[model samples]
Target: MEFKNVSVVKEANVYFDGKVTSRTVVFESGEKKTLGFMLEGDYKFNTDAEETMEILGGDMSVQLPGESEYTLYKKGESYVVPANASFEMTVDKYVDYCCSYKK
Candidate 1:
Protein backbone atom coordinates (compact mmCIF):
# COMPACT_ATOMS: atom_id res chain seq x y z
CA MET A 1 0.00 0.00 0.00
CA GLU A 2 1.13 3.48 -0.72
CA PHE A 3 0.91 5.99 2.09
CA LYS A 4 0.83 9.52 0.77
CA ASN A 5 2.06 12.35 2.96
CA VAL A 6 1.83 10.50 6.24
CA SER A 7 3.71 11.12 9.44
CA VAL A 8 5.37 8.14 11.06
CA VAL A 9 6.78 7.86 14.54
CA LYS A 10 9.08 5.28 16.15
CA GLU A 11 11.10 2.44 14.68
CA ALA A 12 10.80 -1.21 15.60
CA ASN A 13 14.22 -2.61 16.45
CA VAL A 14 13.08 -6.13 17.15
CA TYR A 15 15.73 -8.76 16.56
CA PHE A 16 15.01 -12.42 17.15
CA ASP A 17 18.42 -13.63 16.00
CA GLY A 18 20.00 -10.27 15.30
CA LYS A 19 19.43 -11.08 11.64
CA VAL A 20 15.64 -10.68 11.61
CA THR A 21 14.46 -7.14 12.09
CA SER A 22 11.59 -4.68 11.54
CA ARG A 23 10.88 -0.97 11.40
CA THR A 24 7.86 0.73 12.99
CA VAL A 25 5.58 3.20 11.29
CA VAL A 26 2.85 5.20 13.00
CA PHE A 27 -0.01 6.82 11.20
CA GLU A 28 -1.58 10.16 12.00
CA SER A 29 -4.77 8.46 13.16
CA GLY A 30 -2.85 6.92 16.08
CA GLU A 31 -2.65 3.49 14.52
CA LYS A 32 0.70 1.73 14.40
CA LYS A 33 2.28 -0.86 12.17
CA THR A 34 5.61 -2.43 11.37
CA LEU A 35 7.38 -3.30 8.18
CA GLY A 36 9.70 -6.23 8.71
CA PHE A 37 11.85 -8.88 7.16
CA MET A 38 12.43 -12.32 8.62
CA LEU A 39 14.94 -15.02 7.87
CA GLU A 40 14.26 -18.73 7.93
CA GLY A 41 13.29 -19.49 11.52
CA ASP A 42 10.46 -19.99 13.97
CA TYR A 43 9.16 -17.04 15.93
CA LYS A 44 6.64 -16.48 18.71
CA PHE A 45 4.97 -13.16 19.28
CA ASN A 46 2.47 -11.80 21.80
CA THR A 47 0.12 -9.00 20.95
CA ASP A 48 -1.21 -6.35 23.28
CA ALA A 49 -3.94 -5.36 20.83
CA GLU A 50 -5.62 -6.84 17.79
CA GLU A 51 -3.37 -7.17 14.78
CA THR A 52 -3.68 -7.87 11.10
CA MET A 53 -0.51 -9.20 9.56
CA GLU A 54 -0.03 -8.85 5.83
CA ILE A 55 2.53 -10.80 3.92
CA LEU A 56 4.19 -8.49 1.47
CA GLY A 57 6.78 -10.83 0.09
CA GLY A 58 8.01 -14.40 0.38
CA ASP A 59 6.07 -17.07 2.35
CA MET A 60 5.39 -18.29 5.86
CA SER A 61 3.54 -20.94 7.85
CA VAL A 62 1.47 -19.63 10.70
CA GLN A 63 -0.09 -21.30 13.72
CA LEU A 64 -2.54 -19.34 15.75
CA PRO A 65 -3.60 -20.33 19.22
CA GLY A 66 -6.13 -23.19 19.24
CA GLU A 67 -5.47 -24.08 15.63
CA SER A 68 -4.33 -27.62 15.03
CA GLU A 69 -2.80 -26.99 11.63
CA TYR A 70 -0.36 -24.46 10.37
CA THR A 71 -1.80 -22.27 7.64
CA LEU A 72 0.25 -21.03 4.74
CA TYR A 73 0.32 -17.30 4.11
CA LYS A 74 2.01 -16.06 0.99
CA LYS A 75 2.50 -12.72 -0.62
CA GLY A 76 -0.61 -10.49 -0.70
CA GLU A 77 -2.34 -12.61 1.95
CA SER A 78 -3.21 -11.49 5.44
CA TYR A 79 -4.30 -12.88 8.81
CA VAL A 80 -5.85 -11.45 11.93
CA VAL A 81 -4.82 -12.13 15.49
CA PRO A 82 -6.95 -11.36 18.52
CA ALA A 83 -5.80 -9.04 21.25
CA ASN A 84 -3.74 -10.61 24.04
CA ALA A 85 -3.28 -13.79 22.05
CA SER A 86 -0.04 -15.18 20.76
CA PHE A 87 0.84 -16.65 17.41
CA GLU A 88 3.68 -18.67 15.92
CA MET A 89 5.29 -18.26 12.54
CA THR A 90 7.71 -20.32 10.54
CA VAL A 91 9.50 -18.61 7.74
CA ASP A 92 11.18 -20.61 5.07
CA LYS A 93 13.06 -17.72 3.56
CA TYR A 94 13.39 -13.97 3.80
CA VAL A 95 9.77 -12.95 4.26
CA ASP A 96 8.72 -9.35 4.11
CA TYR A 97 5.64 -8.36 6.12
CA CYS A 98 3.52 -5.52 7.32
CA CYS A 99 1.86 -5.81 10.72
CA SER A 100 -0.86 -3.29 11.59
CA TYR A 101 -2.35 -2.93 15.06
CA LYS A 102 -6.01 -2.15 15.56
CA LYS A 103 -7.76 -0.37 18.40
Candidate 2:
Protein backbone atom coordinates (compact mmCIF):
# COMPACT_ATOMS: atom_id res chain seq x y z
CA MET A 1 0.00 0.00 0.00
CA GLU A 2 0.77 3.26 -1.32
CA PHE A 3 -1.22 6.41 -1.27
CA LYS A 4 -1.03 8.99 -4.01
CA ASN A 5 -1.87 12.63 -3.62
CA VAL A 6 -2.83 12.47 0.02
CA SER A 7 -2.56 14.78 3.03
CA VAL A 8 -1.21 13.90 6.42
CA VAL A 9 -2.41 15.73 9.45
CA LYS A 10 0.52 17.21 11.36
CA GLU A 11 -1.11 16.99 14.75
CA ALA A 12 -2.07 13.72 16.33
CA ASN A 13 -5.37 12.88 17.89
CA VAL A 14 -4.51 12.12 21.47
CA TYR A 15 -6.70 10.15 23.84
CA PHE A 16 -6.65 8.56 27.27
CA ASP A 17 -4.26 11.10 28.77
CA GLY A 18 -1.78 10.59 25.93
CA LYS A 19 -1.84 6.82 26.29
CA VAL A 20 -3.19 6.59 22.75
CA THR A 21 -2.47 8.76 19.77
CA SER A 22 -2.99 8.60 16.03
CA ARG A 23 -2.04 10.53 12.97
CA THR A 24 -4.72 11.29 10.47
CA VAL A 25 -4.30 10.71 6.76
CA VAL A 26 -6.71 11.85 4.10
CA PHE A 27 -6.76 10.25 0.67
CA GLU A 28 -7.34 12.19 -2.48
CA SER A 29 -10.78 10.70 -2.82
CA GLY A 30 -11.63 12.09 0.65
CA GLU A 31 -11.50 8.82 2.52
CA LYS A 32 -9.76 9.03 5.87
CA LYS A 33 -7.83 6.69 8.10
CA THR A 34 -5.67 6.83 11.19
CA LEU A 35 -2.45 5.11 12.14
CA GLY A 36 -2.05 4.93 15.89
CA PHE A 37 -0.18 3.59 18.86
CA MET A 38 -1.53 2.68 22.24
CA LEU A 39 0.34 2.24 25.45
CA GLU A 40 -0.48 -0.19 28.22
CA GLY A 41 -3.84 0.77 29.66
CA ASP A 42 -7.55 0.27 29.44
CA TYR A 43 -9.75 2.63 27.48
CA LYS A 44 -13.38 3.25 26.72
CA PHE A 45 -14.38 4.84 23.47
CA ASN A 46 -17.54 5.80 21.70
CA THR A 47 -18.08 6.11 17.98
CA ASP A 48 -20.32 8.14 15.77
CA ALA A 49 -19.49 6.18 12.63
CA GLU A 50 -18.86 2.52 12.11
CA GLU A 51 -15.17 1.71 12.38
CA THR A 52 -12.89 -1.13 11.48
CA MET A 53 -9.75 -1.40 13.54
CA GLU A 54 -6.85 -3.60 12.56
CA ILE A 55 -4.13 -4.50 14.97
CA LEU A 56 -0.73 -3.86 13.42
CA GLY A 57 1.59 -4.73 16.30
CA GLY A 58 1.58 -6.18 19.79
CA ASP A 59 -1.73 -7.45 21.13
CA MET A 60 -5.08 -6.14 22.30
CA SER A 61 -8.07 -7.32 24.25
CA VAL A 62 -11.33 -5.73 23.29
CA GLN A 63 -14.85 -5.82 24.70
CA LEU A 64 -17.29 -4.44 22.23
CA PRO A 65 -20.52 -2.82 23.23
CA GLY A 66 -23.00 -5.31 24.70
CA GLU A 67 -20.28 -7.90 24.97
CA SER A 68 -19.25 -9.33 28.34
CA GLU A 69 -16.08 -11.02 27.26
CA TYR A 70 -12.79 -9.55 26.21
CA THR A 71 -11.46 -11.00 23.01
CA LEU A 72 -7.80 -11.02 22.18
CA TYR A 73 -6.64 -9.65 18.87
CA LYS A 74 -3.06 -9.99 17.79
CA LYS A 75 -1.21 -8.34 14.99
CA GLY A 76 -3.04 -8.53 11.64
CA GLU A 77 -6.36 -9.17 13.31
CA SER A 78 -9.26 -6.81 12.84
CA TYR A 79 -12.53 -5.99 14.57
CA VAL A 80 -15.55 -3.91 13.73
CA VAL A 81 -17.36 -1.50 16.00
CA PRO A 82 -20.85 -0.42 15.16
CA ALA A 83 -21.87 3.20 14.90
CA ASN A 84 -23.20 4.90 18.00
CA ALA A 85 -21.80 2.17 20.18
CA SER A 86 -18.95 2.15 22.63
CA PHE A 87 -16.20 -0.34 23.29
CA GLU A 88 -13.59 -1.15 25.87
CA MET A 89 -9.98 -1.84 25.03
CA THR A 90 -7.39 -3.37 27.25
CA VAL A 91 -3.82 -3.06 26.09
CA ASP A 92 -1.28 -5.04 28.03
CA LYS A 93 1.64 -3.93 25.89
CA TYR A 94 2.37 -1.18 23.46
CA VAL A 95 0.34 -1.72 20.31
CA ASP A 96 0.05 -0.29 16.85
CA TYR A 97 -3.18 -0.15 14.88
CA CYS A 98 -4.85 1.17 11.79
CA CYS A 99 -8.40 2.45 12.12
CA SER A 100 -10.60 2.99 9.10
CA TYR A 101 -13.93 4.75 9.31
CA LYS A 102 -16.80 3.47 7.23
CA LYS A 103 -19.13 5.59 5.15
Model 1 — TM-score against the truth?
0.90
- Model 1, 7-54: lDDT tens digits are 655655768866578887777787778888999999898989999999
**Per-residue lDDT of model 2, residues 18-103, tens digit only:** 99999998987788889999999999889988999999899999999889999999998999999999999999988899999986
What's the distance in Å from true for residue 54, model 1? 0.4
